[model samples]
Target: MQNRALAAATFSFVVAQSLCGTLADADWPQWRGPSRNGHSPDTGLMESWPDGGPKQLWIYKNAGKGYAGPAISQGALYTMGTQGEKSTLISLDANTGKERWTTEIGDILGNGWGDGPRGTPSVDGDRVYAMNGGGHLVCASTQDGSILWHKSMSEFGGKTPNWGYTESVVVDGDKILATPGGEKGTVIALNKETGSLIWQSSDITDNAHYSTMVPANIQGQWQYVQRTEKSIFGIHAENGSVLWKTDFPGRTAVIPTPIVFGNRVYVTAGYGTGCKAVEINEKMEVKELYSNRLMKNHHGGAIQVGGHVFGYSDGVGWLCQDLESGEEVWSEKRALGKGAIGMADGKLICVDEGSGKVMLIDASTEGFKEHGSFTLDPQSEIRASRGKIWTHPVVINGKLYLRDQDLVYCYQVQ
Candidate 1:
């Protein structure tokens, strides 16, 4: 009897362990991926794609109109789009691309490029957060798309930018951080669970641009680093106090999120404005290390791999630059048109916005070398006349997700 009891107990324990392992989430829960650095934690991906690109497993139509990316967590995918007369939050099964739920968040934003949300939905545990282009912010339940709490950026003195609110709010710890740029504050931290105000950064009163905030621990001090059209600054994550401020000659639009490497912060912009790097010490002192036009990344987003930064410069084409020295490593101008980029498994997956062409290349400092390239078929006929395939490439859990207006294609990449 004692031997039988021991065997049963061991069997139950093993079953529980197996269940937990299967349910564990491998997710890209927010904009710019899990770390907001455009890097994927996934490994064992295809080092080189087949001639026609990775096999397309499924295609999800009716994602609606938006440049927003998808956020995958807990087996569900979340994104924003215009469902009808209103901007809507959408949830779908990550594996099968089946519609789960949709919740209207705000009025549809009208733009020449397209009409829809610009920010990706951010998923946090059982809740998800999204900001429509109309400056309306909503926190919704991840399961049924029920709105938990909702707030507008206008309540915090935020004026919608000319292109609309394109920020993907950062949910750090117990607080949700957002930029509602005005005289009242440039940044605000709200209670994630209740949607109440915590604190606001009142010192820097700059107008909000399209960039998102990145959290960094500098010399043991945790803060949120953000960039505006005129400045790059850091605010204390706890009280929203201004920690450091530096000048950036950003013009036209500053659309890329600031990249924080060690104690150094790097920012880039488009429309003739270039890139710059600044170092912040423990004492909160700021010093500019280098500034140049080597990386005039428009809105495609930039990623840092080791000590080098890679992105598509407006006129310079796709290039790699040393993060610290600001020296150009290598550039390829004629290979691909201007587009967004993402990284996975030590490789770069780049998409050309003009033609919906996808390319897989080695993320190497030696030079630009293409591993594989293919153009997206059945491109959207409803895309704005001015809008190309503007959405960035996202790779997670062996699947590659790409969007062209209402069409969301899933390809097996592992």
Candidate 2:
């Protein structure tokens, strides 16, 4: 009877975890943490760094020529870069920063800014998915880095954009979603296990941009929200049907991932396109809440903490904007230069693109208050002349990860 009770209790615990979407261990398994919101689900982190900064745990200096950030899951860190003539997906020990294995993605992508991949890897269960700049997507075994399946975005009628394919694929349940934007479809859903086509968003055929797709559950409906050069839209998860879309006059590039909270979706871009927010109703109606130039974030991603959004604007420096009213809360231009932003433990981590400087700021609406700051030691010498540090920061498991070209630095933030 005791053994029977233990079995029943274990079963109940598993069921509850599945229903709540809880994992046994903490993981930053994709582009922007678990939810792709530039927020880490980590607590008990150091609120302020000591004098200089957090303690450097390890620095693996051979990440290769790419701006892709690291994705960590189950003690393994995954990222992509270029090696010789091929783009490669690499896995490293999350604790010691030791190389574990690597698999070639495809031919190397030669671009003016840099010559390598750009999209981060997405780890789901025991399989990991990654994309090269040339639109080669591959799924491989997480344990051995063995290829399970592969596909090309060009096969789905996608035309390579000026910047290449920089969007990380979304893995949700049984489907993996990608934006291979063109006339045939804007987004394509494939069977996660077999790499077979599930469906495509045929209604909207905009060119793909650099932003990644975000999955949201709004109005009790599951959908994937994405931003392109022309519009911001949501597609039904089960089918590739377009639920709603709104026009966005994006310029040179629309690079930031769309942020979805509750029933509202917020998107921003650089090149003076500005930012906008729209709310979706249960009946699939879309209403633009506000549109303004308060946050013209180019590539550095934005984070939403509480009711405010924090990021670097083009004209303005580091700034915080009210998400509800589309107004500037505060601006701190001299604090940090244009770069990426991430959040953890009630604080914001900001990086400077020109110099590899990292700063910890209060994620508050009152003002731009910083707790600590540090610059990257031994910054990459092989970095392109025009390529400033573009990779976004990732914090999970009490560690902060930053990448500059081939140099990947890990700091103990606990």
Candidate 3:
């Protein structure tokens, strides 16, 4: 009876975890943290960094070459990288800078800007999903880094973008979503357990660009929001039906993930194109709220803290803009160079692209109030002359993770 009772309890625990996602509030298992918004729910973090920055906990110098950011779940960190002509999905110890395992996803991408993978890996309870530069999507065992199922997004007719596919697969419940951008069907949903075709958003087909898709619940309508070079759209999360779309004049690349607040969605791009915000109505339609160049965030995605948005713009440096009014609250070019940013505990954690500097700033709408800053030491020499620090800094479990080409640095930000 005792053994039977123990077995029953174990079964119940596994079932509960599978249904609840088993992801802690502080675990960042997906694209831009828990909510895919570049924000962390962690508190009690340092209000400001010291003169030199937070304490560097440990550094893993063999992370290979890639711009993929690290995602953490259950004390394990997952990221994609490249070694020689092969691309790999790496699993690392979140507390110590030690590699647990690596699964080679596919061939290397030799982009002139940089070579290797571009999208971060998404971690679920016991499995991880990653997409390679050439559009190969792989589902692997998080325990041993063994590939379970691998397929090219091109199979769905997604022609790889010129710069290659930079999308991280989105996993929801039993369906795993991927963008194979072309004509057949842009966004395809596969069975997470079997990698079988579930559905495709055929109603509105736009070729995949560099941006990752974000799941949304607008007016209680479940859908996925995404952007292409020429347009912005949302499709029903249940049946892959086209909900709504709007014309977006995005130039060069549409790389930043769409930011959703309430029923409104905000998107921005680079190469001269600007930003726009649209409201989703009761009938699942869109209404443009405002469009401007106040924040032309390139790949360093922006974050909306409180009621304001913050990011490093092209012509401008760091910027703070009002979310609802679309007004520029303040802009600063001196605090740091062009950089990527993450947010936690009402403070903006940022990294400079050119100088490889990490900074902590107040996420207030008042002004660009920098609290502290530091430079990433021994930066990558393998990067192109124009290639700077492109990896977005990630903060999870009171530790900050930053990566250059082949180097991954972990810092204790608590």
- Which candidate number would show the highest TM-score if scored against the true structure? 1
lDDT tens digits by residue: candidate 1, 1-414:
899999999999999999656544788999989899999888889989999999998788887898889999988889888778899999999889999999999899999989899999899999999998888989999989999999999999999999899999999999999998999999999999999999989988899999999999987899999989999998999899999999998887899989999999999999999999999988999999999998999999999999999999989999999998999999999999999999999999999999899999889999999999889988887899888898899998889999998888889999
Candidate 3 residue pairs in clash (backbone atoms < 3 Å): 158-180, 181-207, 181-208, 182-207
Q: Mind giving the per-residue lDDT tens digits that candidate 2 earns over 1-414?
A: 999999999999989988545432679999999878888987888978998899999999888899998999998999998778889999999989999999998998888898899999999999999989999999999999999999999999998889789999989999999999999999999999999999989998998988999999989999999989989999999889999999999998999998888999999999999999999998989999999888999999999998989999999999889999999999999878899999998999999999889999999988999899999998988788888999999998889999998889999998
Error of 2 at 8 (Å): 22
Query: Over 4 Å off in model 1, which ranges?
Result: 1-24
Clash pairs for candidate 1? none
For residues 1-414, write the lDDT of model 3, one tens digit per residue: 999999999999999887555323358998899989998867789888888888998888777878998999888899998877899999899889898988789998888888889999998889999998999999999999999998898789888888889998899989999999777778999999889989888877787889999999989998999889988998888888889999999987899999999999999898878899999999987899999887888999999887788998889889998999888889999878888999988899889898898888888877878789899987887886667788998888889999998899999887
Per-residue lDDT, model 1, residue 86, is 90
Worst 10 residues of 3 by lDDT: 17-26
Ordered list by lDDT, greatest first: 1, 2, 3
Over 4 Å off, model 2? 1-24
